[model samples]
Target: MRPSLTPVPLGVEPMTRSILFEGLFVHGLPRNEAFEAELRQAGFDRGDLLPQYPLRLFRQCMDIACRHFYPGLPVEEGRRKLGHHFVQGFTRTVLGGAVAVGMPLIGPVRFLKKFPEHLRFDTSPILVQAVEVGERSFRMEFRTGVGLSPHFLRGMLEEGLRMTRVNPTLRVVRHSPISFDLHITW
Candidate 1:
């Protein structure tokens, strides 16, 4: 019998925290007072979120914000929006500059091919498996081990492709409680 998997709390890298806050600010959300309240309700505080802390609190805070910001919004839609916002926010960082430098040379296909190496799994639970299906197409599967919602993964993948200068089409080929697969074609 398969052992019961204990859900692990994942860490949010500094870059991710920066992206999330920037995304919230871009959306015109009150990132200070309101966000603090949300964090408190989610069992965390500003102190707890320093740089590289477990993301459970942040995820919980986002969930609360999603409900408040977009009342009656579908979870999937919220995740997608969050994903897009994350990329926008990420683009303003130092790492974004490095990625931009490679845009002209690497292009989206090669970037996606090497995307998995970008994730810092030592601090986070997110894992990615990329399978190249064609010259400019691929299937990327994210395994979060129940730490994150699949819809969020879908959105991140979609926007990441777009940032790579590709007008890619993304389809959710599969989804489950712990993982999801996205088929991307440029």
Candidate 2:
């Protein structure tokens, strides 16, 4: 069984962009009544999600998606697959046009250097720090408490770099309640 979510602090409500949900539902998962009902149980109404959603809800939604779509897989593996699909789904959406066009031109090295800034462009109120450790590698540290699995991040980074025509290898070097580090090399 997967561990429960860390409780959000009182009076601090972090939110996520609805575009993320749009990517998940429209591109990653089949949109059906069953999926919609599952989202509702996780405190989201698929049809009603609009400009933004609670960050907690987003995490729960991702977990639910992983469970539904990868029931036979381990939790970590399922979330990783979900993350990989999320990038594919996200880039196909109209809102993700910039990513589709910009990533190829930027290349993996440059893209990794600017990942933190680029992330802010799409998702706000989350803190990520990217440091270039070598010419062909970098370390991304999640500074704020995102609570996202490192395996999931690995999949996302792998797919994002793959879009630039390079395959990236990623691993979790450090993990804690408030932060985590992913070392990525192409």
Candidate 3:
């Protein structure tokens, strides 16, 4: 469980003495319902084997991850595949676990979206700069302000990354955006 402190809004100046970053990949997303209804109406079966969550609450992290890995795919097609794969994965896992995996799945899903997984970079503000050298990565900025503590700052920086899952043939990484101005062309 995350400690009792509140998280700073993203893009706001951070309130810590140092900064860090981490990389992540995610899985086990639940499907949302509105999309399910839409899918059924469109003649796509909301397969009994792969029941999904409501659309407004759907966790499309894996979908976003796909777009990152396969950058050239059309957005709409990627979106569809993402939804399909999410349901397949979600169903397969839960079915394997059987009744034991009941309601608790939702708890973590809801919690993570509200809060997020964190990944930290090397913990030093002085070495940081905004540069964009990689595709799908962005230059993010942070500053130490009020409510700043070494531990909390570290946690905040690490949020939003999910790197623990070990199955599936996909990969995702969330590193800090490279500094575009720091030229190192070889």
Task: Using lDDT, give the best candidate's number.
Answer: 2
Cα deviation of 148, candidate 1, in Å: 2.1
Tens digit per residue, CA lDDT, model 2, 11-118:
767677787777776676777778789888777775676788776777788788877788899987887787788788888788676678888888998778777775
lDDT of 3 at 120: 25
Clashes of each: 0, 0, 26
Query: What tens digits encode model 1's per-residue C-alpha lDDT throughout 1-186?
Result: 323433454552412443454443333244567756766666655444345334565576668767766557887788667766666666665666566566657778777878787755344556777889988889887776545655666676777777667788788755666667888888
C-alpha TM-score for every candidate: 0.73, 0.85, 0.21
**lDDT comparing candidate 1 with the true structure:** 0.64
Name the lDDT value of residue 141 in candidate 2. 77
Q: Write the per-residue lDDT of candidate 3 for residues 44-79, one digit (tens) a residue.
A: 333532222222112233234444544687654454
Q: Which candidate is the best by TM-score?
A: 2
lDDT of each: 0.64, 0.75, 0.30
Model 2 lDDT at residue 27 = 71
